[model samples]
Target: MSKGPIAVIVLSHRDSEQVTRLIHRITEGTNSFAVIHHDPSGEPLSIPPSSQVAVIPDPIPCKWGRLSLVQAQWKTLQWVARNVPEFSWALLVSGQDYPIRKMSAIEQELAGSPYDAYLRYFRVGPDPAEDVIPWQALTRRRYLYKRRVPFSRRSVTLPFKRRHPYRNGVELYVGDMWFNLSAPTVAAVLDARQMSERMLSYLRFAPIPDETFIASMTLNVHPAPNVAHDSKRYIKWGRRQLHPQIITAEHLPDLRASDAFFARKIDRLAHPEIPDLLDRLAEERTASSG
Candidate 1:
């Protein structure tokens, strides 16, 4: 089957080596494009030849893990949209993510399909208490009880002046942040800056703008039929924690049954099964296609 060019945008803080390795694996036998957004303060490293690496200027004095990282990701996406022509779909992979399916299988599944897989859930009018606030507040406590931490003292806040109260009986659904977006969706997000000053203004204060912004905009602009409500990425939440628990060999059964295109929070140092798992998944995809 013929395939349109796919753009893989890797979001990383200091893991250039890991990102490079993933790019190598992804482009092994296909005409794929890759862009790495290396945080300015990350360790110095060389990007392999034939790949595009954009390093954010150092000393930007931005938090490595918060909304700043999301901003960096948006910038990288904008760059890809402008520089890479004929790009059909954009895959947003983190430094810690590993593919559980072969690129061939993924391409075949997505061939000529306009739907993009992203984590989406339904929420009633009374949005979840946490969702209303920016992500930084929930994750980093950037804004707590009207007081800001030293690092977040001057940080921009989300547009919501006051937190919306959620009624006790209302149900809320929240899920993963990672997503695979179509070119048009990507373009729409990039264009959000131009269309809505309110959104662009909210970027600074909206702690985890990355998670909320795209999902909110997509829900508002795109038709419901075009959006993949659930992204096929395997993620396990830790004990009362926000981030997904690390993936280990013990989770292999669930991963296999997940029908997920990728899995995250892999322990590269401790979990040696990762590479083996990827290999097995690739073989499975090959056999299925043949």
Candidate 2:
């Protein structure tokens, strides 16, 4: 497989040290660059200076379950497009995510793959297939009237019906927020976004917009863009869970067997031993490959 340069974009709200470690691991022996986007609302991340890593000076104030999350990703994508044109692929990872395989191996796997984007996706709304996000989620975000207390931390929503965002034959597609995207795919989505304010407004009001925005841009377009139903990240989404299962030492065996490039949602404060084990695994993998 012919290797090409890759740019790893790390979106972090906390855990600066871990993010730096991740950058070091990726840049140790590979032709790759790291772009760190830290949310300004979180604790200030003290990322060590590195020739291979660039941190965004003005980070977005990302909010949970809001359009701000998608805004942060938009900023990161724009930064990569303007600053790292040499990279053929852009991989988005969170601070909690750590690589499971050697950088060389990841590059080799991507080099031979046919898909332009490695992301999990499914159609949503109007009698969607199984596993797709139900229409209720979309309705709650877009159609229902939500009322919030001025100072209290409580809100209420009233059920209602309004126009679905998908207009003029445009279909809604939802997927995992993390993705590994090719240059062409990124360019296409950004270009379309710049040209369409209606699409932007529609997605901004949609529920969990981060999960739907990019998927809609690429998958809904004509000629159906090249996409693969895999993110190459080991994430366990348990039943009725709002987020992925937190990774711990108990999951090490499954992580090793996954053959994924990275695993997600790790928190050192909650599971201190897990990161140590993962660090050991990374070291062993790198040494063996070397």
Candidate 3:
């Protein structure tokens, strides 16, 4: 295993202060560092200089539910892998994510994990015999032909009629985009087969391609390596609109008990105490470990 630090790729489009704080939180007590990909058109960011953090210059302009988001993330990761030699692992998280556990322990767990990846990846198909979930409308909407009704606000997905079912020969997979990838799995994703011309061609017009691109690419390998379906993240999308429920102080009990290493969609400005509570939890872990 590589003895290098964990690399955290952060997609920050807003709230520079919160993003800056998040970078420090993830790297404060661990060797892990952060690469911030702030949107080129978003709010200007001012973060303190640190050896543990670097910001990608001119982050691609990303539109939600568009291919640009996926492209920016993939390119940022590739750049990091080439620049930061032998990183033990790399994880993708948003600027809104905060560690629910100690960063050092989180890094240790990933560094020692047997699984090559920790993300929610499952095949989407109608065949039950293949251990795939029933075909989902959302899946169809994402993969099938869709025209973006641009010039609104964020990219909107009004999928065209099922028309030609987008299928890559039973290899279609879907999952949340956030994930942690070991060095080998990272290399596998970077392989020519995974980042192929065909895959890019298909994803160019697909809705929310970022959610499917990495999962479809990484999980389609033959003799797939052990992959934990758990993303080790706590995010609640319970019957809400587009945005997830913002974590509040009331969620402390759940946060304390969850196995998740990180939680997202948290507004630190709104729930400032949340971080202090998490910091206490980390201290409690340290105390217990001691």
- Judging by TM-score against the true structure, name the best candidate: 3
Q: Rank candidates by lDDT, best first.
A: 3, 2, 1
Model 2 segments more than 4 A misplaced: 1-4, 128-160, 194-196, 283-290
User: What CA RMSD would you report for each candidate?
Assistant: 5.7, 3.4, 3.1
**Model 1: colliding residue pairs:** 135-208, 156-205, 157-205, 158-205
lDDT of 1 at 71: 63
Backbone clashes, candidate 3? 0
lDDT of 3 by residue, 146-235 (tens): 544445433345535533323545367788789888877787778745345567776666656777877877786545757899888888
Candidate 2's residue-wise lDDT over 111-211, tens digit each? 78788888877765555244344644553443334433333434456465445556577776777789888877787777775334555665555545677
Error of 2 at 170 (Å): 1.8
Return the TM-score for candidate 3, rounded to 2 decimals.
0.88
Candidate 3, superposed: residue stretches over 4 Å from native: 126-135, 145-147, 150-170, 193-195
Off by over 4 Å in 1: 1-3, 51-65, 114-117, 127-175, 194-196, 222-225
| Candidate 1 lDDT by residue in tens digits, 175-213 | 345667777677776665643344435444544445554
Return the top candidate by lDDT. 3
Which pairs of residues collide in candidate 2?
none
